[model samples]
Target: MSIVAVLNTKGGVGKTTTALNLAVGRALQGRNVLAVDADRQGSLLAALSNRGEREPCIAVAQYVEGQALRQQVLRAAALYDDIVIDAGGRDNTALRAALLLADKVIIPFLPRSFDIWSLDDMSALLVEARAIKHVDAYALLTMSDARGTDNEAAGQAVPDDMQLLPTTVGRRKAFADAGGAGLSVLELPAHRDSKAMAETQALLAAIFN
Candidate 1:
């Protein structure tokens, strides 16, 4: 079993969107998936509410406070091959614990100055996180538009010192619309934006494979 944690220090970076779509994509690939909402706001839980499975997905709030995390993982692992943990953006002990529990870590950043600044903290956390986990950690820039900004090229460009994923989820109305209805963009496509979908899919594929 693998524990994939979606995290970032800054809010509104599409961390939840990436988490939801990636887990759904993993499930679509024939891997049973358990998704956890570690954020206090329950964004992941809200998204999965309509999932309507006989058994509910495990939200991380219950286990994030203590060593109960091991038990939580054990219970969920019995039912799913993949476990996706949606961690909080703020710096806290709970978030640190989630990172320690993750097999692989994903930091989703937006293409803005403050969003870029958030990666500094993300990098430090993962550095310590890697000492505990055996897998590679990745960073992905979300809501990016290459043709729009002067920083576009550099925005999507992976930091030389940081490990990053190859795909960047572009700014799109579809993503925002899907989140409002508690659905992943993959589940709700208004128009054909193959680029965004492909980028998202590649990120999901890379995390699982």
Candidate 2:
């Protein structure tokens, strides 16, 4: 019965990747999961198809556009144990509605300067989401390389007011290939015991545990 919205005002920051994998990752762990494709771009939907899901993924746009029955939205989603909304990279009505419904709002960003710089914008959006739903949001650092001491040090330098995930995804090709297959990084055998999976699992654990 928990709603998690994956957001970042800045696109290409692994927001969709996080949303896609985290949903599948949770489901693979035996928790029922529903992935809501809220972005009109249909990136999630395209990725879902690549993953070869038998069930129709519920696209919020379709619900809003009258292509699908709205009453069936939550009911269809409820068939799963967890619901994830891929909110794209902007602030809009759909994103707002997802925020109001979310129990946790997870924002993922890279370790670069622009990625770090974009935090303020997302934080403001999180504030707006909180103003509507009264829920706190957290940020997760993605695509990090420990060997790149600078990125590692940057994460350690985060202020107390900000939250940086303890586990980080090192530079790995598995992520890109896995996404192409509609599979999560966790779903990749090589990543099962990798740091990326550990970090992702830790994030999921924080939410469900």
Candidate 3:
């Protein structure tokens, strides 16, 4: 089994959205997925509840304490093919705990200056964590603007310790539309933007490959 933790010390970077979509995507592909909500706000669980019966069911567990979180993940590993953890957007106990158990770590960030600057701190944390664990960590660019900013140049600035994914999720109405109703962007109807769906699928492919 593989455990993936979606985390970023800075909030509003679409970390929960990414984690939710990843869990649902894997479930759609017939993998037994378990989503762990480590954030104090419980946004992940709330999103799953809002999902209703529209999307594939994903098992969920909540663990906030660092040691407890690690123990829960270790125990759940035998029951699911994949575990996706939604951790708080800070260098908190929950995030550190998830990092300890995660087979892979995903750090989603916006391409803006402030968000870009935050990666330095995250990179340092990841570097230290990796030294004590065997985990593949990546930096994913999300909420990318198609206008004004140079996405490519921005991606190049990712720290060498973390690999930057090739596909980026652009800021689009489909994301908001789907999230509002607790649905994965992939589950959006035919009228939805194909680019949004395509970007999500590309990320999933990269994640699982």
1 against 3, candidate with superior TM-score: 3
Each prediction's total of clashing residue pairs, residues at least 3 apart in sequence or on different chains, is: 0, 1, 0
RMSD vs true structure, all candidates: 3.1, 3.8, 1.3
- Candidate 1 structure quality by residue, lDDT tens digits, 1-209: 78888878788888888888777767666677777777778777787776565232333233454255556765677667888878767976657766787778888887777888888887787678677765456888787776767345545554544676777788887776666655556665536566667776778777766
What is the Cα-based lDDT of residue 92 in candidate 1?
A: 68
Better of 1 and 3 by lDDT: 3
Tens-place lDDT digits, model 2, residues 20-118: 877877777877777877777777767877755533332222222222322434566666677887774766666666666677777777878877777
Give residue 71's lDDT in candidate 1 (0 to 100).
60
Ranking of models by lDDT: 3, 1, 2
Deviation from native of the Cα of residue 139 in model 3, angstroms: 0.8
- The positional error of residue 129 in candidate 3, measured at the CA in angstroms, is 0.9
Model 1 segments more than 4 A misplaced: 53-66, 146-161, 189-192
TM-score on alpha carbons, each prediction: 0.83, 0.80, 0.95
Candidate 2, after superposition: displacement of residue 67 in Å?
14
lDDT of 1 at 51: 57
